[model samples]
Target: MKQTRISVLAVFLVLAMATAALAATEVRMVGDALVYGSFFSNRNFTGWNAPAWTSATPTWSKAGKKTEEAFEIWERFRLRTDFVANEAVKFRLEMKVEDTWGHGTFTAANPEVAIMIYGAYLQFKLPCTDVDVTAGLQNVALPQSKMFYGSPVFGDRMAALVVKAPLIDKTLSVMAGYGRLIDTNRTYDTTTTQVADELDAYFLALPITLDGFKATPWGAVAVAGKDANLFTLKSSQQNSSFYADNLTSAGTYATPKLWKNDQNAFWWAGGAFEVSALDPVKFYADVIYGAGAESDRKKSHRSGWFMDAGVEYTGWDVLTPKAYGWWSTGEDGSTANGSERMPMIRPNWGPGNSFLFDDSQELVKNSNMGMSPVGSWGLGVTLDDVSFVQKLTHRLTFLFVNGTNSARAIRTLNTLMGSNPYFQMGRDLTINEHVYGVNFDNKYMIYENLSAVVETGWAHGEFQQSVWGHSLVNQSRNGDTWKVSFGLSYKF
Candidate 1:
C-alpha cells in the first residue's frame, strides 16, 4: 500500500540521521542548483491549422490549412540538497539533472539519467507544541490565486503528509496536507488493470495576517479509490511524446486525461489576498468557490468558479504600473465531462495569462490554459530598476481575450472534429477569437546567482463571428500569432 505507507517515514529519517551523527549540532550540509534554458518561436498558425469559415464563401481557408510555423527548444535542470540536523532537524533533496541542450554526448551508453523525485522533504520541529512536521516528496503550493492552485501549472511536486501550526498570532499560520493523486500498479495489470488509489488533497489552510496583508484561506479535495469510481484529471507528467491518446477500438491511446467520471469528489474553497489598503498602489483580489465534478449532463452538477483581480504601481521602484482582470467559468463543452469544467482544476497559465490560449489563458507571465477561460483586461508596465541597470527587470503586457473555443476545451476535439460536425460544439465550428496581444519581458541579474530572460509576443486573432453571417458554420480560425523567448536562469 504505497510502500507500506512510506516505509516508517523512511525509517524515521534514518533514525534521525543516526542521532545527527553523534550529536554535536554540527552535521550540516547545503547545496542548490537550477538551470533553465529556453527558446520558443512561433508565427501565424491558427491554433494548429487555420483557415475555415465556409458554407457559402465569405472567405478564408475553412480547412485548407495555411500560414504555419513553429519552434521549440527548452532545457531545465535542478539539483537541490539540504540536510541540516541541528536547530530542529531538516532534510531535502531535489534532483532533475541530466540535460544537454541539444544532445551531443554525455552518453554512458545508458548509465541511467532520469532520476526524478522533485523533492524529498522532511522538516521537523514538534516536540512540545510549535508544530511543523513535513514529510517526503514535497512542493505543494496554494494560498490560492493562480486561478485555483497554479505554478508551472500544478506541476509543483506533491506527495504529502505535512502539517505546520501557529494559528492565533506568531504570524498566524496553518497548513495540513495529503496526497497520492493516483495509484495503479496491478503488478502489470492483474486482471483488467483495476486497483486504483487516487487520494489527492489539501485539507485546509489559514495564513492570516490582518494589517500586514497576506491572507490565505484555502481548502481542497479529491478522492477516487478504485478506477471505476472514476477521477482521472491526468496530465501529471506523462509526456507520452507530448500528449498522445488516439487509438480506440481496442487499440486504446488517449492519456493526457483531463477528465474522467465517477462524479462528485472534487472540491475547492478559496481566499488569497494581498491588498493592505493599496500600499504603493498594489491590490489583489482573489475569489473562488467550487463544488464537486462528475457530470456529463444527465443531471449536471459539477459547479464552477474562478476570479483574479489586480493592480500594481509600486511607487516607481523602477517604473511599475499594472492592471488586471480574470475570470474562469464557462462550459457547454458538451460532454466528455467538461460541463464540470472549472479551469479543469486549474494550473497552467502564463503567456499573458493564456491569451496564449489552450488551457485557457490567464497571464502573469505564463500558464497553460483553456477550459472555459477568460481574460478581459491586462495593462502593464515596470520598465526595470533601470538607470544603469540594477539587476534589470522589464515587463510590458497587454492582452484581451474572449473565451469559448479554447479549442473546444478538447472533449475529443469538441466532440468529434469540432466547428460543428454533428452538433454545435459551440456552434460555428468552435467560436473563440478576440485575442489582441503585445508583450515584452526582460529580467537580468547576470551575476549574483545568475539570471537572464527574454520574452516576446505579438498577437491578433479577431474572429468572434464574421464570415458574412454566422460564419458559414464555425471550425475555428482567425490568425496571426507571434512569439520569441529566451531564458537562462541559474541559482546555486
Candidate 2:
C-alpha cells in the first residue's frame, strides 16, 4: 500500500510541474455573458412554421404543435483563451454554454452539463518570413463589405488551414484556405466501407489597401459527392442547406432522388470595397455571383447574383446616419431552368440592426426568425448612436423589402407543396408581396463591462390573395408581427 501511494504522489508531482511550466507562458482571456427574455406575437406572419388554422386556435402560433404566443428566457456565455509564446505564435481556444431557462430536463438540483468547443486553432508566423498560418477549427467568412458583417454566400466556423502572405509591403496581400464542411462516412457510420460522401471548399482572396480606399476580391469553389448529407435532410426555412434539394423545373417539391453525376461543383466570385476618401462620408459595397451543382437534371442546378451597398455620414457628434440597399435575382416562372436565387453554404448578412433579417443580435436566441436576403431586395435607413443621456444610447431604423420571385412561380409551388412547412406563404413572398418594419433599440451602461438592452420591433406583411390563394391569405391575416426583448450583457 505504501508503494502504491508513493507512485500516486509521483504522478501528482509530474502533473504539477507540467502545469507550472504552462503558466510561465502568457495567457489571456476574453468572454461575455448574456441573459434575455423575449415576448413575440404572430412570429409566423403567414404560412411558414405556423400552426394550422382551427377553432381551437384563432391567432397564429409560432410552431405547428404550439397554440400560444412565443415567449421564453434564454442565457449564454462564451469564453476565449489565448496562450502566447511570443509575438509571432499563439494558440486560441474558445468555449460556450447556452440553453433555455426551463424547458429541458435541466434543473437547479440536477443541471445538465453541456459545454461546446467553439474554436481551437494555432496561429504562427513562419521562421525568417512574413507569412502567417492558422490551422485547425476556426471561423471562416468570405471577403465582403464590413457594413454587411460577413459574406452572404458563406460565413461560419469550420475546420481549415489558412495562410496569409504579404506581397507589396502595406499595399497588397493574399489569403487562401481549404475547409471540409461534411464527411458523412465518418460522421454517421464509420464501420461501413461504402464510398465517402464529402463536401469540401477552397477559397482565395486578394486584399488591396490604399490611402483612402480598401477592397477585397475573393473566390471560392466547393465539391460535393452525390450522396452528400445536405441533400438527404428534410428541407426547412431555418436551414439554408435546403437550397440543395432537387427542385423540379415546374416548381414542385419532390422526394430526394439519385443524381446522374457522382460529383458536383459549386463556385462563387465576389468583391467588396470601402471608400473613405471623403472622410466623414464613407461608402461600402459588395457584389457576388454564385452557381452550383450541374447535374443531368436541370432541377439540380442553381445560380444567381446578389449585391448590396451602403453610405454612412459620421460627421454628426450625437449620431451616425446610414442608408443601405440590396438586390438579388429571384426565381423565374419555371423550375426546370433552375432557381435564380443564389446558393449559399451559410449566410450571415444583414444591413443595420433590422429585425426582419438574420442580423447578429446582443440577446440570446432572440433573432433569425426565418428571414434571409437570398431572393429578395430591400432598403433601410438607420439613426445609430443617438444619445442624449449619459451612459445611454438609442438606435432607430426603418426597413422595407419586396420579393423578386415570380407570382406564378410561387403559386405553382404552393399549390403542390402547400402542406410542406418549407414553403411558407408570407415568409417566401412573391413578386406581388412586400413587408415593412421599424425597430427601436436602446442600451444603458451599468458599468464599463456591463449593460442593459431593450429592443422592440413591429412588422406588417402584405400578401396578395390572387397569388397566395385564399387559405394562405386567411392565415396570414391574423395580425402584424410584434416583438419585444430585454436583456443584460456582461463582458470581460
Candidate 3:
C-alpha cells in the first residue's frame, strides 16, 4: 500500500508541472524617473513696461525689474504582464503612474494617489483567418516622421477596439480603431454629467512598403459633445473663470474668460514616408492638414485650417540635420460666430530638451504634461546626435516662432512659489510677436539604464498685450529670457 501511494504522489506532481509549463506566463516591468531643476533669467520677471516706456508704473510689478528661478522633479513608471491562456488566446495588462513632485496634498491625512491604467487589453487570432483583434484600453500612435500625430496627443491611454489584418501579406497592413475620449458618466457631485457630453474618436491607417521605402497614410476624426471641451468643462486643471467673476475660485485675481457651450468636430489626414531606399543618404518627410469647426454652438464661428511639413537627413550618427515648418490660420478677433484659430494641439518639438526648456511652454501655451505647440507656427533646424566622447552625446536646435491667431504672449510673470495667477490672459493681443531662440543639449550615459543630461535655452523676443491692469494702452514687451537645467533619469 505504501508503494502505491508514492507512485500516485509522483503522478500528481508531474501533472502540476505540465500545467505550469502550458500556461506560459511572462511578466516584465520597465520604468523611468527624472529629477531636474532649472534656473531662469528674466523668465518670471520682465522689465515691466506695463504702462509702456514711462517712469512711474513703467514695469508691471511693484518691485520694478525682477528675476526668478527654481527646481522641479517628475517620474513615470510602467508594468506589463503577458500570458497565454490557451493555444490561440493571449492577454496583456499594463499600468502606469506619472506625476511631478508635490502633485496634491502630500502631507494631508488622506493624500491623493492616482495610478492610471495605461494598457489593459486582450489579443487573439481569428479562427481560420490571418487577422488579429484587440479590445479594451490600448496604446495608439499615428504615423509621423516627427511627432506630428504620434502617441496619445492629449493623455495616456485609448479605450478602444482595434483590428489589424494583412492585405498583401508582409507588403501592406491595414488597421482600424474606435474609442471614446470621454466616457459617458453620471457623477455623484454633478447631475448635469449626462451621457450626451461624452466625446468619441476613430482612426484608420494603412502602412505599405514599396521597394526599400515605407509609406503610411492615416486619418482620424473626433467629436466633442456640447460644452465638453477643456475650456467649457470645469476640472481641477481648468476653469471657465465663472467663480472668479464672483470672487470664488482662486479669488478675483484669476483671469476671467467665459467658455462657450460648443459641439466641435475635429479631423485630420496625413502621410509619412521613410526614404530609406538610399541607405546612408536617406530622407524623410511628414505632411499634414487638419480643419476644425464648432459650427453655431458658440455663435462665434470657430474654424481653422492647419498644416505642417518636415524633412530630415540622417547621413551620419554624429551630425544628422533636420528642418520643419508649420502654419495655422489665425483668428481675426471677429465676434462673428466663434473662434477661428485652431483648437487642437500640435506636437511640440522643442528647440532643446523640451522638459528642461521650451518656448511653447514658457512663452505661449503650457500644460501639465509639458509643453503644447498649438495656436502657433514656425520653422526650426536641428543638429542631432553629436558624440565626440565616449558615453556623451550633444544636440543643438534653433527655432523661430510667431503666433498664428492672436498676439499670444504671456501677460503676468511670477516666481515659482509666488501666489500670482500662473497664467493670465489679455483680450487685446496680437499674433505679431515673433521669437528667435537657440538650445544646447548634452546627454551622458552613466550606466546601461541611467543617464544624466544638461540643457540650456535662450529666446529673444516679445509679445505686446495692452488690455491688462486697468489700462487700454498699456503695452508690454519682455526683452530676453533664458533657462539652464540639469537632470538625472533611470530606466529599466
Candidate 4:
C-alpha cells in the first residue's frame, strides 16, 4: 500500500510538472496564520458529584475538581500559477498544519501533524463551455451542511473528473471520483501507522435562478471496501469491568470482528430553495434521505434522513436578524432496532480537548443501527451594519437531542462506553438527557487587515444517571452537568 501510494503520487507529480513546463505562466503564493486559545470550567469535572459541594475529604478532592485550558496555532500556505495561454490551465499546491500547545489533559492527545494534498487539479476553457478536472486530494460538493452525505471533516486524495454544460440558458454540473479516505491514527499516548483501502464517490447537481429565487437539486453516492479495522475499536468495552481483568488475564480483550458485509455504501438526494416571494421576508427549506449498507453480504440495511426549514426577516432594515434551525438523524449498523446509541467520550486534559467529542464509533454505529433518529434545532440572530465597529454578527442557539427508545439509547451508550478500557468496570451511562445552551461570538477589526474575535458559550445538560454509570444515592430526578467556555482568536 505504501509503495502504491508513492507511485500514484509520483505519477501525478510528473504529470503536473510536464503540464507546467508546456505552459509558461506566473506563480503566486498565498498564506494565512491563525492563533486560537480557550479556557473551560465544568461543575462536575469527572461527572461525579454535581452542583457546588465542598472538598471536606481528600477523596472528594480526587473526584470533583476539574479545569481545562489550551492553545492552537494553525497556518496554511498555497501556491497558484496561472498560464498565459488561450487554454489557460492553473496549478495549485496547499499545505496546512495545526500546532497544539498548552496544559490540559485533552490537548495532550491532539494530532501533532496532518500533511496531505489539500487541492490539486487542472482546468481548461473551451469555446462554448468550460471544463475542470481534479486528480488529487479534494472535497465533495453537497447541499446545506453536508451532514447527510458530505465530507466536511476530512479530504479525499483521489482522481476526480468534473464537467459543466450550459443548456436552455441553465447550467448543469456532474462529478465523479475515487480516492483513499484519510484516517488519522492517534491516541492519547501514541500514534499508529496504517492506511485503509481506497473509496469511490460521485455527485450530480443543477442550479437555476428566477425572480430573485434560486433552487438547486443534488444527488451523491459513495462506496468503500470493508475496512472495519480502520474505524473499529480495539476492545469491546474500554471502560467496562471486563477490560482490566481481560487484559491482565489474557493480555487483551477480544475486539469485535468486522462483518464480511462491512463494505459500506451511501446515497443521498436533496434540494434547496431560497425565495424572495415576500419583499423583506425570505424562506428556505431542504430535505435529504441517505442510506448505508453492507455491500459484500446481505443482512441488515441502514438509512437516515435530514430536514431543515426556516424564515429570514430581512425587512428589519438596520438590524436584520435571521432565525434558522436544522435537524439531522442517522443510523449506523452498530445498533439493532429499538436500541439507543451511546456516544463514546474521553476526558481531555484541557479546554481545547474538552470541546471535541469522540463520537466516531457512535457515528459509525448510527449508520448501521437498525433505525434511530437524533434531532436538534437551533435559532440564531445576526446583525449586519455598514459602520466600522457595527459590522459585527451575533447568534444565540438552543439545541435539543434525544433518542426515540430508551432501550436503543442504552445499548448505544453501553457500546460506546464499553469500548473504552477506562470505563470497563462499569456499564455505559444511560439517562434521559436534555440540554440548554447559549453562544456569543464577536468580530472586531483592530487594524486594516487584522481582526480579532472573542467567543464564549454556556451549556448545561440534565441526565438521569451519572456519566460513570453509577446510581445516585438518592433517587433524585434532577442531576445535570454544566459546561462553560471562552476563547480568543486572531487572524492575519
Question: Model 2: residues >4 Å from true position, as ranges?
Answer: 1-21, 46-65, 187-193, 231-258, 466-472
What's the residue-level lDDT of 386 in candidate 3?
83
- Across residues 1-492, which tens digit of lDDT does each residue of candidate 1 receive? 354345446545645865666565444433434333332332322333322323211112333244333543444555565667666787776655444434422234532233445678888898867888888788666665432235222435567887989878667888988866445442454576444434455567888877747778787776533242122232323110011010000001123233344333656787878765667776766776665544422323345566677666667655755666666554454443434334233244333323343322211222121222321323332242333467786666675655543343434443333332111211112335455566576777788877776666666554433221233223234435556556566666
Query: Between prediction 3 and prediction 4, which has the larger lDDT?
Result: 3
TM-score of 2: 0.87
Worst 10 residues of 4 by lDDT: 344-353
Cα deviation of 366, candidate 4, in Å: 24
Query: Taking the tens digit of each residue's C-alpha lDDT, what string does model 2 give over 42-61?
Result: 77674234423221111122
lDDT of 3 by residue, 99-154 (tens): 54565322245434555556778988899877889988876556665423342122
The global C-alpha lDDT for each of the candidates, from Candidate 1 onward, is 0.47, 0.74, 0.51, 0.38
Q: What is the TM-score of each candidate against the true structure?
A: 0.28, 0.87, 0.69, 0.62
Per-residue lDDT over 280-344 for candidate 4, one digit per residue giving the tens place of the 0 to 100 score: 88877666665554342232333445565666666754554455554554223234331112111
Best lDDT among the predictions, by candidate number: 2
Kindly indicate the candidate among 1 and 4 with the higher lDDT: 1
